[model samples]
Every structure is written in structure tokens, then in C-alpha cells.
Target chain A: MWVALSYACWGISIVLALWMLYDWFKIDTTYSEEMLTSSREGELEAVSEKHRI
Target chain B: MTIAAEPAVQVQGDRVSLLRVLGPAHVWALGVGIVLVGEFTGWNFAADKGGALAALIVCWIVGLLYTSVAMIDSEVTSTVAAAGGQYAQAKHIVGPLMAFNVALFLVFAYTMLEVSDAILLGDTIVAKAGVEGLNHNSFIAATIVVLAWLNYRGVLMTLNVNFVITAIAYVSIVILFLSVSPWTQGAVLKLNELVTPGNALPYGWIGVIAAFQFGIWYYLGIEGTTQAAEEVRSPARSLPYGTMAGMITLLIAAAMTWYVCASLMPWEYLGITYYPLWDAGKLTGSALLENLLFIATLLAALASANGCINDAARAWFSLGRDRYLPTWFSAVHPKYRTPYRSILFLLPIALAFAFIADLNQAITFSILSGVLQYTFMSINIIMFRKKWPLGSIRRGYTHPFHPLPAIVLFCLCVVTFFAIFLGFGSQLIAMVAFYFLISLWFHFYRYKFVRRGAQFTMPWPKPQGY
Candidate 1:
């Protein structure tokens, strides 16, 4: 029974991690349209802060 | 009156801001980076309390609790993006005094964690390389200088390095797992036998309670991810997703790391070992694997140190910039937009403490402060929701079950905090005394100098129905 519980814990944790991995990879396309529009503002800010030290 | 002509009136160009250099990947790395060291070390201490099986159970329970907290914190971060994080959450919901207490809890806790991480790195290297008479104090101080310089360069550079170091650390875990995955129930010591009640959970049910202090290691710094809310792009979405990834990754890593290591030996043996992974690698009977595991453990500690230093400095920056603390902490590198002055100010102090502090005390006090900070943040969530009701506020995300999760977590933290304190009588008393001292200190600072009508209302997300 204890062994079963141990494996069950591991199983649940692995599933959660796999789900998060899937979510992490989807970042680029999830908000592609918004990303495109915002890129212009982001570019100017990036340039301004580029050599910040 | 022309807005530009009025010195008090600020324009868009005049508002100083942190650069949005972090994307989803950077946020994910930083979230995991700050806490990933849990996989390498610290988990074994729980074994001392409740044997291996009890410790494993403790890790699982703590992992779930922290994951829940991280999810709730995600919504708060997305709605009101700021460097102040939980501190800012309290300010909007409770008031400045509560906000002050929360900020001090976070700042001091992370600073302590940073110091401890550096010390751990120095000690781990000394053990790994077999260097006698090594000046770890000098080693830690030098390492902090390099880390601070990296941070001063820019957030982008600091996070990029974090991503690389974090990735290597994770890969190391994967390697260790794969190397031992094929072992058949441990030729050295079968896991099932080791977990039998008298063996794995020697102290009985009460020992499980004692184990929670160490259980905190698995997910302690995962919440530090929210400290990066101001730096991430599309914070509403990115912050939540990044933290979810980080929590899930840590949960899995903790379980696997515990399982494989415990499979090799009894908690009696593994629990006392200074480097569990390095020793666990020997059960595979491969020298190459052992060395690889040891190196990975060191890298993991370094990554955590990097993240903790960055998180602590940012917290100081937010406080200093808001005039809650000294304005000197608010000074940013003119070009990099990073809080160089704040990082430098705390670096020496952290280094000094790292040399004298004990490992157990570092872990306990960190969790103690966390207990206070999270309690305030969770209650703040309930209060904020009450003030703005569902559909009344323009929030980035809505948590299901309203404030049930917050209330549940707050109660759980309170109960668990006191329960864990049962084991650390002296430390608990000392922490409470220090807590009072700081409260008095903050009161003096505020009462003496903070003038009337000088403070402005926070720009929290406006309530739609209001």
C-alpha cells in the first residue's frame, strides 16, 4: 500500500510537469498577434536600455 | 496649468521604468532558477525528522501547498504588475503598515537565502574538490562580486546566464535520474524495506509534523518568480504560465530526486550524508556518474544564489524607490536600468551573515518569514476581492472558488507554522523578538519623517463597477 502511494505521488507530479512543459512551449504562438503589435514599442525601449550598466 | 510646466506633473517620457526584457522563457527560468537548488540538497534533512518515507511524504505535501500558493499569486501578479510583488499586494488591500511588514519579511528572507546559497556553494566546492584550508569566506565574497557585476550589467544578461545555469542543472537531474532508473530496487538497499514504518518513519505520526521545516526546501523560492513581474513581457499571461511551469517542474524534480536517492540506502545512511546526490550516484557503481552528479549539484546551488541575489535586490529597489526605505537603494545603473546600488548595498551585508549563519537556522528563519509574508498576501487577496467583488475589478485572471483557496492556505500556513515551531523553541522566540524590533524601527522611521499629504494613492487596477 505504501509503495502504491509513493508511485502515485510520482505519477501525479510527472503529469503536472508534462502539462507545464506543453504550456511553456506554446508561449510564442499563444499571443502572436499581440506580440507583433507590441514589438514596435518594445524595440524602442530595448534600444534605449541596450547598453544599460 | 500646463502639465509639462508643473514640476509635480509627470509625463510619459518622465516616468522611470524597468525594461521589459523577460519573455516567457526567461520568466520560467528565473522561477525555476531561484528554487531549483532544492533538488540538489536540503531535502535529506527531513529524513532526520521522520525517516525517508515520511520525508518523501512531507515533500509531496509541501510541494502541493506551494503550487497552490503560486497559482493564486499568479493572478495577483498579473493584475497589478510591479517590483514590490506581495508587498504591493498588501499595500492596496490592507494599508501601508501591513505593506511595510510584508516587505521586510520578503527582503530579509530572500537576503538570508542568498547568503545561505553562497555559503552552500563554497562548501560544496570545497568538498567536491578536496581542498584543505580553503577560505570559504573569501571565496563567497569574491563570488558575490562577480554575481553583482553580472546583475549590474543588465537584467537581460543576468537572466540569460540564469537560463544557461538553470538548464544545465536540470539536465544534470535528468542524467542522474536516467542513470539510476534502470537499477532493480537497489542492490545496496531496497526502497520498500527502507520505507517500512519502523525504518522510514521511525518517529511515528509526530515526526511527520517535524519534517515540514525541511519540506519547505522543495518549493520555498518558487514564489520568488513574482518578484520578476515588472520585468516580464505580457506579465498577465507570462507570470502565471512561468510560475506554473516552475512549480510543476520543481514538484516532479523533488519526487524523483528523493525516490532515486532513497532507493540506494536507508535514511539513516542517506540522511546524514552531506551530498546525497553524489553518494546516491555511487549506488549505480559508476565513478563518472558520481562526478557528474556532484558538479550538477554545485551548479544548482550557484543558479539559486544568482536568482536569490537578484530577487533580494529588486525587492530593496522597489521599497527604496517608493521612499519607504532609504532612497539610496533606488539608484539604478543609468544605462542598464538595473538596481546596481541596491544590489551593492546588500551584497556586503549578505556576505557577512553567510559566514556566521547556521544551515538549519537559515532554513527555519526563511520559512518563518515566508509564513508571515504569505499570510499577509493571502488575506490581502480575500480583502481585495471583497472590496471589488467578482466582475467588478478589471483583473488579468480570476481564481475559481473566490477566496476559498486564499483562506484555506492562510489557515494552513498558520497551523503548519506553529506546528513546525514546536521543534525550534529557541529559534522561534528569537525570530519573534527580532520581528518586534523591526516593527518598532519601521514605526520610528515613518512617524518621524513621513509628512502629511505627501503620500499618493496606489494605481491599483481600477474597479470596473465603481
Candidate 2:
């Protein structure tokens, strides 16, 4: 029973990992390099905003 | 196309960045969480080499090493304000070649540490439960997976969890210290154990030098807090306070751990025992302390693994973003605003190390890689100050007694390499050769992919000496 639970955990991780890879491919195919690396969001936020508590 | 100097407000819809949501508290959590595991185990090997007193002295000596590390890192990281921490600093201060090596060091250091933590977490659970046929790999995979998912979702949630678990593990050490009642004049401790001449320095002064390598286990990953620079809301304010606070916390915790364990047990036994805190707790004959120490051990591994996942992914992400590696790994999650691909990509590599690499080898690699970074940091800071003098560019937090700390850190790193050689001579030589081969690959093949001008992201003026 304990062995089964451990395998179950691995199974969940495999599924999650696959989902991430799928998302990765989808985004890669959808966006151009110009759009993807155009500007860093943190730099933009740094200019005018501070995180509110 | 060049990255614009002006803030690109219009690109927010298409090109996302990591969320700038972390505060100093989270920064403290990230640094302390990665290091608190050392307080649980791996440090007592020093006691085995030199003796309890020697281990304590080496611990302070290593504390100085990491203090210099934290000081240099805080000053640079605050000004750089990038995700890759030392790698980013290398790119701006040094050049692409050094940056490539720093990235490799960051990735391997955290990834291997993560692997060690996961394996330990799995083994600890199985050992504690008295399970006969449980697969340790399954628990290891799950620990990595869940933490990666949390990291993939967002930095805030990942570090928030780190804060809670790291705090619990830290408090457990304090509980053990108080329960022993060290202030009550040897209530539960065998004070005589400390003064036994044979027990204090059995192997002589040579043993003290040998003990220096394991002393690194006391504060291995505290400098990792700087990896969160880009995500932090206020780098200038947060990095210095968080990094220094984390250092002070580790110093106290390390001393407390040594005091409690060294006072309760003879150095000969304490040196060879795995999980010295747990053993010390058992010596008190209190089931409550023993069980709590067990739980604390488990939590420390979990916390360290979580922070490792966070740090390793960020370094990989920064590398990708700058085209140091393939650009495909650079994408941020559109909605989650996290480096989802980088997090998932490092998952398999960490798992591979966890299963195939010997735990001791993995840890040695991690320590050696960290020492390489510290050695370079001393050089990096001196260059930083020389190229960009005090008033040349603004600094978030400047370390005092300029050049002294850098000199001390460099000297300590050289000493540590000798200590490592005295014990694991072959591993030391192999690590140097491995890095050498990879540096060649980056120079010969990978440099073409990187955009040289765009790589210097900081808006500072041309360097002074340049």
C-alpha cells in the first residue's frame, strides 16, 4: 500500500511535468522572439511602482 | 533589435517578466531556508575530523567566509537587480566568458543541493515510518514535483511556504537548546564531555585544518538570497537587510546546534553520527525532543529543496533570457508570470542526480562549485570597485573596510581548496577539469548565440578604467 502511494506521487509529478512541456511548446510556436524578449517586466515596474502591502 | 533604455510599457501584454512581489521577509526566508538544513546534518563531520572544539573554531572561520560572501553579494546584487545573482554580476562586471562559468556554477550548485535534499527527504520519511519495501525515488520525485509546481505557479507562494517551514525547523533547534537548559549549570548536559583532553583535539592542529572543509556545511547556501533580486520589490532596501539578517540567524543557529550536541555527547561519537541533533535529542531521554528533532530534520530538507528549486530555475531563466543557452527556455508564464519552462526543465536533471549520483559526491560538487563562486566574488568585487569607483555609480549597500573583506574571502577560499584536497583530492581535481572542459565549450560554441551589447542590461555609465 505504501509503495502504491509513492508510485501515485510519481505519476502526479509526471503528469505535471508533461503539462509544463506542452505549455512550453505552445508558447514557443505562438510567439516571435521579438515579442518574447522585447522588454523585462520588472524593469518597467521598477520605474513607477512599489508593491503595496 | 536592441533592448530599449526607456521602460517598455506597451510590451507588457506580450513579454512578461517574473513578478516583483517579494519583500525583505521573503528574501530572508529564501536565504535562511536554503541554509537551515546544514544545521541539521552534514556539519558534524567536522567534529569527526578535528574534535568538538576544533569544529566550533572552524565553524566561526567558515562563518567569516560566508559573511564576506553575503557582504559582497548584497552590494552587487542590489545594484544589478537581476534574476541570475552572481551570474548577472559576472556579465556586467567581468565579461561573457566569466558569466557563462558563473551560470554553470549556480545551476549545478543549487541543482545538486536540491537533489541531495530530495533524496534525504525521501529517505527520512521511509526510515521514520519503518516501511519495508517503499520506493524512495517516488517520494523524491514527489518532493521535487510539488516544489517545482509551487515555483512554477509563483515566487511569492513558493517562498511563503519556505518561510513557514524554515521558521519551524529553526525554532526546533532553539527548543532543543532551551530544553537542555545550558544556563542551568549542567542540568541535562555532561559538561565534562567538552573538557576531556582527548575529546577536545584528538588529532592535533592538523585535524583543525582538515575540519575546515565540513565547516562549509554550516552555511552553504545563504548567499543564494541574491537570486531573488529581480523579483524583489525593492532591491536596494531588501537585499542588504535580508542577506545580513539571514547570516546573523545562521551564526546563532550554528553555535546553538554545536553547543547542544557537543555538550551532550563525546566528540568521537558525535563526529561519526548522522543527524547529530536527532541523536543528541535521544540522549536527553525525552521522546518529545526526539520526535520534534525528527520532524525538524524532515522540514529542513523540504525547505532547502524548495528554495533550491526557486534559485536554480531563476539562474537558468536568466541564462536563457540573455541567449546564453537556447532562447526557448526563456519564456515566462503568461498568466502566472513565472519561468515555467526553466522550472520544469531543471526537474529531470535534478532527479537524475538524485538517483544516480552518490549523495556525498553530489554534496561535494555543490560545495566545490560554491567555493568557486566565492573565490570569483572576491575578484569580482575588487574589479567592481576599481572599474566603478565609490561615486562612479550608486550602490545599495556598500561593505565597509573595502578590499579587506575581499582579501579575507580569497585567502579563505584558497585554504578551503587545500582542506578539500587533503581529504578528497581526486574529486577536487575532477571538479576543476569538469569546469575547464565546459568553459571551452562556452567559448568555442555558445558565444555566438549571445547578443554582446544587449547582455549589459544595467544602465550604468561606461566603466571607469575601461
Candidate 3:
């Protein structure tokens, strides 16, 4: 039973890996300068107010 | 045919310029790394302290927690995509002091791992050549030069190495599994569940805790991918997805290796040998299979060495850029665009440590810092949403359950970190803690590097001067 379950997990992981691999190739490769100009950019907050210079 | 990035200052405002050619797949490959050597060899050590089942249970827990952390980390990648990567995330959420700590940990861990990889390569080469008294240092130096050259060439070439190394590694692992079908008719495939007097669980529960220290090694370097987040093409999309995908691949590799090794050999026996998979192939399979695994071990180490160099430079680049270190540390080669100087800076340190430091001690120190880095990532998540809020930070894929993943991962990481340090004898932990305090003192008091805003890239719509 334990062996079966371990195999099952491995199976799921393999399938997920294949999916990731497929997506890895299909996803766009070019750097998107537009991404910088489209999202909210200026409302920046320091990570920690206590430590910020 | 080519989509050129907009002018550096126009889009990024001048303080940024890494050629972002890496896509999601490249990022994913980098994330999975060459192989989880721990899962392949070192994890059995954990089984000595924790029963086989106990070791397996601890691995499951650690793996699942890391998956959660990755999910949360993806959110970080989406929000603040910078060359600084996780250190930047920590900077944005925790402050430069904590970022400084995390950065040092990453730098130390990567350099230390590279040392081990180089020594392991030397050992493997001597064995393969069947040559006595091979000058190991020369071979190690040659390997470092090759690794450094690949990285110095730029991200695309370094990435190209990742593609070839990772493919060979995966193929080798497949070959190993096929050599002996532990899931089926292999003679050693039985459960060996006789829990009578001297069963697999001899040390009982105490053993499980011991086993986990090694078990965590399986997924140790996956987070190094986060270092590459800055160089990805569409980091917002690729970083989150790539990281999670990498984690899943490692999980599968870990499970397959654990099942095969545990089923085929006595857990105690597996712990003693350095090359568990290579040893497995020797005992049960043909000579050809044993040779393949021997080659696999070297190839995997090569992949890891290459990965460490690239990521460590980026981490160093981040520190240099932020003025935490000397400015020259982050200086880019005019032609390569890669941080050539930073890579060089790490090489000497890596060489020194590789020759002098014990391999086990190197791995242990690397793990200690790795766990702390993970804990810092979780803390970044907990503070990130609050620092930027919903409207301020763009949502690529928000991790479900808000802070649950962060909280859970933080607990697991800290406990593991403490346990491993304690195992090294409390004095080592004390020294590390003391170093931590000294760094904190330096950062809060004597450290004088002020932030000179660079053309930092944030995942927001409108470009802002960083």
C-alpha cells in the first residue's frame, strides 16, 4: 500500500513535470518592456520602515 | 524576427541592463537544476536516525512545505522582479539588513556548494580514468575555469549550458531506473517490513528526526532559480510558474529515488556509501549500468557547479548594485553583460573552500544558510502584501490562503534550521549566531552604503525611478 501511494505521488509529479516542460517551451521568450509601463509602479513602500535608510 | 527591448533609460531609467532572453522554460530548467544529489545519495543518512518510514514522512512534510513556500514565492516574483531577486524581495518587505543577511547566506551557500561540486568532480575523474595520484587540484581548477567561462559569456550561453546539462541528467536518471525495475520484479523490490527485533525501525522515532537533515537536501538548490528571476523575459509570468514547476519535478525525482533505494537495499547500508545510486547499479545491474551512473554523478555535479556560479554572481550583483558591497562587485563586462567581476570574485573563494573544507561540513553549512534563506523568503511573503497592498502590487497569481503558507513554511524552516545547527554541536550554532549578530551590527551602525537608485524594474504598469 505504501509503495502504491509513493508511485501515485511520483506519477502526479511526472505529469505535472511534463506539463511544466510543455509550458516552458510555449511561454513567450522576449523581454517585455511594456510590462514595466503597464502595472502600478510608483506606489512603492519600503520593505521595513525600521530598517529603511 | 527579433523583439528588441525598449531603450534602457526610456523603459527602465538607466540603472538596469541585463539581456532578458530567458523564458519560462529556461527558468524552469534552471530551477530544477542538474539533479537532487541528496535524494540520490545523502538522504539515506537520515534513515539511520529516523526509521525508513520516518525519513519518508519527514521528506513528505518538508517537500510539501517547500511547495507551499514556492507558491508564495511566485507571488513575490510577480510583484517585484529585480536582479536582486529574493534579496530584493526581502529588501522590499524586510529591509536591507535582513536582505544583507539573506544575501550573505545565498552567497556563502552557493560558493560552498560549488566547492563540493568541484571536489566531487575531481574524485569522479580520478576514478573514471583509473589513474593513481591524479593532481585533483588542477582538475578542479580546470572545471572552475570552464564553468566561469560559460557564465562570463552571458545569460544566453550560461542558459544554453543549463539546457544541455539538465537534459543529460534527466536521461541518465531514466536509464538508472530502467536498469532495475524496483517497482516490479527486481529481486530487492520487496517491502522488507519485518519490524520484529532488528527491523528497519531499530532506532525508532529518534531516527526520523536524524534522517530529515539529509532528506531536506533533495530540494535544497531549487530556490537558486529565484536568483534568475531578474533575468527572465516576462518575470511576472515566468518566475511564478517556473519556480512551482521546478519544485514539482524535484518532488517526483525525490520520491522515485527514495522508493527505489529503500526497496532495493537495506536503509542502513544505503547510508554508509557515498554514491548510493552508483552502488545500487553495481550490486544488481550490469557493468554498463554502473558506468552510466558514475557518469551521471559527474554530470549532475557539473550542472550544479554551473548553476551555483550563475546564481551567486547575480546575488553578488544585487548586493553590489544596492551599495551593500563594493560597486565593482556588480560591474558588468561591456561585451558579455554578465557580471564577470562578481563571478571572478566568487571563483577564488570557491577554490579555497573546495580544497580546504571537508565536503560534509561544506554541505552542512550550505544547508544551514539555505534553510535561513527559505525562512527569509517566507517572511518576505508575510510582509509583501502589506507593504504594497492589493492595488499597489499587481497580481499575477496570488497564493491562496493569504499567510498560511508563509506561516507554515516559516515554522518548518526555523525548526529544521535549529535542529541541523544543534546536530553540528551547539558551539557551531553559537558561532553562526554570533556572525549573524556582527552582520546586524555592521548594517545598522558602521555600514555606510547609501542607496543610489538604479533603473530598477518593478512589476508595475508605469515605470518609476527606483
**In the order shown, what is each candidate's alpha-carbon RMSD?**
12.4, 4.2, 11.3
Distance from true location, Cα of B168 in model 2, Å = 0.7
On DockQ, the leading prediction is 2
lDDT of 1 at B235: 76
lDDT of 1: 0.70
Isolated chain A TM-score, each model: 0.52, 0.69, 0.50
DockQ of each: 0.02, 0.41, 0.02
Q: Docking category for candidate 3? A: incorrect
lDDT order, best first, reads 2, 1, 3
lDDT per residue (tens digit) for residues B368-449 in model 2: 8898999999999999999898888899999998899999999999989888988888988998899899889989998888
Candidate 3 per-residue lDDT, tens place, B347-458, comes to 7788788778766777777777777788777777767776666667567778888778888888887668655854775645764786678687767774576553433335
- Output the number of the lDDT-best candidate: 2
Selected candidate, larger TM-score, 2 vs 3: 2
Alpha carbon deviation, residue B355, candidate 3 (Å): 0.3
* Candidates, ranked, TM-score: 2, 1, 3
User: Which regions of candidate 3 deviate over 4 angstroms?
Assistant: A1-53, B1-16, B185-188, B193-197, B427-431, B444-446, B452-466
TM-score of each: 0.83, 0.93, 0.82
Stretches off by above 4 angstroms in model 2 are: A1-8, A18-53, B1-11
lDDT, model 3, position A52: 16
